[model samples]
Target chain A: MKRFFILSSLLLLFLAGCSVQHKVVPAGNDVPSQKYKMEVVFPKGEISGIMAFKRAGGNMYGTAVNEFGVKVFDFVLTGGKRCKLKNVTGFLNKWYIRRTISKDLPELLNMDFAEDALEYVNYRQNIKYKLILIKE
Target chain B: MKQATIIISFLLLSILPVKAQTDNEIIANIEKASKEMTSLQCSFTQKKQVSIIDEVITSSGVLYYLRDTKLCWEYKKPYSYKFIMNGDKVMLKSGNTVNVFDTKSNKMFSQISKLIISGVDGSGISDKTRFDVSFATKGKDVVVTLVPKTKDIKKMFSEVLLHFDVQGYFIKEIEMIEPSGDKTDIILTDRIINKSIDEKVFHIE
Candidate 1:
């Protein structure tokens, strides 16, 4: 009976530590939207309905929403706009660890920093998207 | 003599109605739709889908539609490629290379133009003349499916679907299924209608 009580108390302590506490701070830009939409046509075919999120900070993230409904943007922009982008999470689908999309692949491969450097990842297709800060 | 007459009769029966469609109905729809198209100067958003390496690659650009058949589409990000269509000539400018295509000689260009004109005008692609038209409503939107009844058109595209809102005649999307079993979906969003569109905005130079 003493052993059972101790195990039960330990399990409760472990479960308490694993409880999820989430705080979502809204992230947005300071400037108002002065953006428009455009389409890109490639030599092979056409890519339409691109959202040019322009004049977005001194630096802007140009978002192109594809027909398949994937949204992709770069971390750099304009002449001086760039992203101080730190890799947060890479395509988190539940508990599975997918691919990494950071330009710093060498950093990600390191044991100390690999998981922190992954951003957007697709496991089935192995497609990774990374954002780089381009100085304008 | 009787055998030859029977064969010719069968051929005539097959070709007559199909021939009548392209002449009377298809052209009429095209003309009507073109007339109602926005003569206005407004920049709109376009979404295009292309399948590459088991995934679709997307890009964005600004489309300036000017007078006549002249429109300049400028790609602003990811890659810089411009499609400038002026009257009968279509010029493509990308990177350091530029190529001009005579739309009259290009069947694909003509088909694309026809599709766009039909879409902008909201004339039913499922018209009895060009397609066997039918509809299925999804929530508030009506999906009009156009199946090519004619042999020639069927050889190009098997079916085309156009979506329209319940209240307005606004065309929201177009889905074209080619004979090769591939599909293309074009969605037009945030369209500004009847604004004062400039004539020179369509010129390439």
Candidate 2:
């Protein structure tokens, strides 16, 4: 019984170390306009884009454009919980891409992640992506 | 009857050679002009129409190209982004970060970039192996339609049309039609050819 208990404790510790902890904070009424260089590395290939985030009237707005100035996605985050995609490219209009963008945008722009944080790294199975906020 | 048939065949054969000669002459003239160009700078206005969404996106940018494979496409309005292709390397800069990739590693990007470079210098119309080229006239503008022969390009674009002014012998506009009926038209203006371009313009850093 003691051996089984020690093994279970070790398993729990291992899982805890792998998990990311995020602290939720209250939504702000306005967030300053900020620009970021967003890079997404997927299984098939990698795509990089410029993202501009702005907040006005308690709603968050974001626009992402590729190197060719082609619009990839434009979305709005309302009340910090619900995400509304205003316009998206044909290939990225699917549910999975929308879900990923909706989740990532808040983490990159929200007050919950802290303004001083310059880098956010995310990993899902074999796919990994990093967002580096550019200071101008 | 035999005499009439022979005459008809001769006329048809003669007309075929005349059409081919016209195409060759046009391509030769474009090539000769391209050879004299050392560098090119121009401002372009791009309009992308997405038929599915019924949306038209307008953007304006500057394009710089150097002979022997170097190009910098910088978009300034709406959003700022730069794509610099130097030889086999491509650098993309957005905001303050830069990403570098080798052309060999990304086949699709390499192909698209090649198309853009060739289109700017009028070499794409001469590449008969990759594309089927035909010429037409719309009013005063000379239009060259290029249909990709390869499956890879056909998947992305249905056809590309290059419009030139017969007087200037330079490209004035380029239009790419996609398989989904989406079209992107780029109008080039304020062109400076064979001008001295600073080498620093090609560097992303």
Candidate 3:
């Protein structure tokens, strides 16, 4: 009886971990190349920058640059489902932060790429990221 | 052979000092102009090019600067945002929200303030201890190219180029090149110098 109870508890823990993982759905990557105004709300304060996305080879590649023209990060979204981070700014290049962004950015991409505005919030980290397409 | 060597040496000696003098003369002119201007207002256009993605992002804004440390950079297109710095205090407004904090409180903000303030006021640009500064003539413009001597600045910018018109001697354009090969050009136009700017422009309190 003791052995069975321990086994069930371990299984329950595994299931809980799996359920916590966020889901990224595959969507069309037909978004045009454009620059989007980006605002990131951190726990302490907020930082703003610009995000630019270019679609090529059925994949969308994006780069974020700060207002001062510093490169923040680069990412590629495959089929709008999986996000692969190519580079990140030195301060935010941590593994945990990269993991969170990979999980969150695709969701923003999935939301009708043609939309003028999009936002994603990572509640676990309490970081809000917003993107607004800048009309030429 | 000795006669030819003397003639060649004479030409080199005569040409080198003139080139060196021209660089110093340009720097002196810029420094002098920066000191005379008490206040400045201008419209600026910033273009950032990312070579990796082959994208160019353009942002235009108005800049207000007071001689010492106060500056207001307001973006007016596609999005609305403002960064106002008055001494140690910095105010950032996005949309309707405003956050005021001290430069000492945030390291990043402090660094940004220093860069923008120094670039606009042309203070540290002439500091030989900080950068290996050189000058070149680009048609009617005098271009000063600075290579960072410190590792901290080198990490941010591989090279910085400041463009000045021969007529005004004020900084007309600034180009910063990053280690990643991306570059940004800020061009200032319609400059109004020595005009009285309202003190309220710097009021973030």
Candidate 4:
């Protein structure tokens, strides 16, 4: 009875450890190209704009504009890995802004991560930024 | 009577010198007229063309300028956005969000805004250090072409053209051609000049 009790405890511990380990899932690559109205909430302030994206030959090209119809930025993502920022307005031409947007784009566009459709809310550095995709 | 005759002769001689400089007469008159302009409010329609993609985008907005420093561009249709520049500070508002920053940190924006303000007022075109200016006449319009001399400006735009109405000396259209063959044309209409503009309109809270 003593041996059996020890064996049972060891099995429980092993099972618990296995259950705590997380499984990593790769994002889906089948998301269709579409236009989305993006709103970014930062620590200083928030900005809303329209983004038009097109995927061709496994590459993504995008252009964004402010509500005043001013062109903000144009970028290209090749093979889902390499990123090239073609043009950007002076106010948003910072390194951190570019890095943050690049990191969050895939997740926001539903190209990465398995999640619900149409809306995504992400938190970074205690600031919450949300992206809502509207179908035209 | 002799002293009065001498004074009249002196005035006529001064006027003759000015008249002899006919090449610069139009620009001088424009500069003189712009000095009296305190504020201006106008509506503008802008059309941008991207040659690579073969796409043309059109937008309309209202523009406000107050003498030297303050300017505002507000868009109402399709969506609402505001860009206000007051001295060294710039503010942009879209929807409920407002982003404010100092223009000193952004040299490119500062330079561009300054050029726009000067261009609208029709005074900076004579700055030979910045642009090579040449004038031409096209029917009732006086067309002025400015080719950028600065490297930073030349990298973005090849040339800028301003069209003025000869009778009123009012700017009617502005065209900017980019190095990449893209062009942006802005047409200003319904202009009201030298109007009293409330100072509160320049501030963005």
Candidate 5:
């Protein structure tokens, strides 16, 4: 299921280019803490970083690493079934700049080559180990 | 006026002749020299490199470290940046920009800082079990190198080199060379060791 969402995001990310705003809304009750580490391989490239989700009242406090592994923005996750990370890392000149992502998306967002692309990116360029734990 | 003063200072320093000891003398002398310092406060200059960019960025600032694991890494010249670590969270200030970081984000950097302070304080280095030592002398300083016999340390720095002054066992400089070849060199100049450093040095403004 996790792999499925990753694939879908990759597909939508490419087709939508810089304007896609798709995401997955978790089915479970509100979890205060979730340690989420994702490696997304787009048909065009790779996305890897850490995200720590702490339930702050109705919102989530998030901290993440940019595509370059540099520490970027830390912002509050508000509204929506799933909050898309919109320039959270806040790097001025990153390919992932202005990108919005969520855990759920439609099938058009999933591409068959996404897994392969992720592997290639991991092997060819950047290696990322990002940890984000959503707290309850 | 401030910029001119800096320029003139650099001009004078550039002409200063390099004075280093021979390899053997450095090794022998450094081996016998030892210090019982609890803390250090001094100014430093750092040159950082990003291989992908193939360029070096130089910065200068004041540094502080306690015998305990506390350290303040600051950059004041060229660019003003400071990283203050309390527990796992970090407050990173770049000039007028300020940022707060969650500790869990980067284990590698967090661990590296712990490793650096440990090496600087000597207590941690002496207590570590997997390091093999090699010594050499260079002009007025003794350079002692430590290679990790274990994999944990081999993950970051292949070897740690400490340059000690001949007059005092004081470490004048330290170089931590990562396995990937990227290295961080910290030159400790005009050190005022154990000179009642302000307790406020640890606070992030």
Candidate 6:
């Protein structure tokens, strides 16, 4: 019984440590569509791309393309909280990568931006995501 | 009748090889033009179709290339971004921040840089060692399809098609098809070849 309790406690700690936590607020009512220059940095390297987002009804949909013009990923942010990845490039379809993107992008969508340009940065799962507003 | 039949057979055999020879000649002419060209300035329109979202995004940009190895690809519509490749170095500018990378140190970037230059200059498209190339003549355009022979490129792109004008032997359009059925088509227009492009255009800062 003691061993079981200790193992359960350790497992809980591990799970908590691995969880993705980001402070998010409700998205503002602004332009219906925008474009950003996105960069995703991992320990090994960085991936640069362009992201286009459109808000319709209550959900925001985004698609990203690499500098070489390859489609990187597509996602939908619902209610400024729920982020569902619609598709990911074959090169970045790993489970861990998907989890981090799904967790971090919603928080990014919830943040406010300047009228002309602004930079937003977030860190999750040992990955850095930066989005710079380029167009509205 | 026997002599006439033999002559007809010989004529058909001679005509059959002409198409293959024409394809090779066209490729050679493009290579020769690329070799002689020193610089090029062009405007391009890129259209990407996202299969998952069922949407099409259109963007326009300008491309500048200097002989040997210098290129600047800049996006001006809907958003602003710049990619410049000078020799073994690459620079990317987004908003206010700029990042520089050494292509020699990064294999992926090195391949991409070379691919862009070759695609624009029409030099390496017919590389028998790197790609399985096929040609189809349609109207005044000769479409060259290149299937990647390397696993790394094959993983990213299923095939690439380059459309060249027969009269000028210059590339008109480039279509890259991904494995997931998504594709990006870039149409080059307002092309001015062998013109003096300012060296400052390729400057990193």
- What lDDT would each prediction earn against the true structure? 0.48, 0.72, 0.81, 0.70, 0.52, 0.78
Candidate 5 local lDDT, B54-136, one digit each (tens): 22334578888765645777867543557666666666665475656555775545655666665565433353476776666
Candidate 1, residues B1-205, lDDT tens digits: the string is 9999999999999998876664455345444544566552333344333121112334455665544566666665545667677888877665565767788876555555555555555555535787787656688776768887866456556788887665554566777765534455656666655566665655554
Q: Is 5 or 6 the stronger prediction by DockQ?
A: 6
Worst 10 residues of 2 chain B by lDDT: B49-58
User: Each model's TM-score?
Assistant: 0.44, 0.65, 0.84, 0.65, 0.47, 0.77
Worst 10 residues of 5 chain B by lDDT: B48-57
Query: What digit string (tens of lDDT, one per residue) describes model 2 on residues A24-132?
Result: 1123423345666567766776676666665555666666655453456666677877776745665566988788767765665654535433444456624444555
All candidates: interface RMSD? 14.3, 10.9, 6.9, 10.4, 15.3, 7.5
> What CA RMSD would you report for each candidate?
15.9, 15.6, 12.8, 20.0, 19.1, 12.0
Cα lDDT for residue B160, model 6?
A: 86
Better of 2 and 5 by lDDT: 2
Candidate 4 structure quality by residue, lDDT tens digits, A1-136: 9999999999998887664321111124344445456566677655566665666557666666544334566666667876666566546769988876666666555454242234445565434445445443
Question: Model 1 chain B, poorest ten-residue lDDT window?
Answer: B48-57
User: Per-prediction DockQ scores?
Assistant: 0.02, 0.04, 0.15, 0.03, 0.03, 0.11
- Tell me which of candidates 3 and 6 scores higher on TM-score: 3
TM-score of chain A of each: 0.31, 0.62, 0.72, 0.60, 0.36, 0.68
Candidate 1 ranges with C-alpha deviation above 4 Å: A1-136, B1-37, B40-53, B66-68, B124-129, B149-156
lDDT of 3 at A84: 84
Q: Native-contact fraction for each model?
A: 0.00, 0.03, 0.30, 0.03, 0.00, 0.19
Tens-place lDDT per residue, model 6, B120-147, is 8897666778789888988999888988
Q: Which whole-number lDDT from 0 to 100 does residue A5 have in model 5?
A: 100
Better of 4 and 5 by TM-score: 4
Q: By lDDT, is 4 or 6 better?
A: 6
Clashes by residue pair, model 4: none
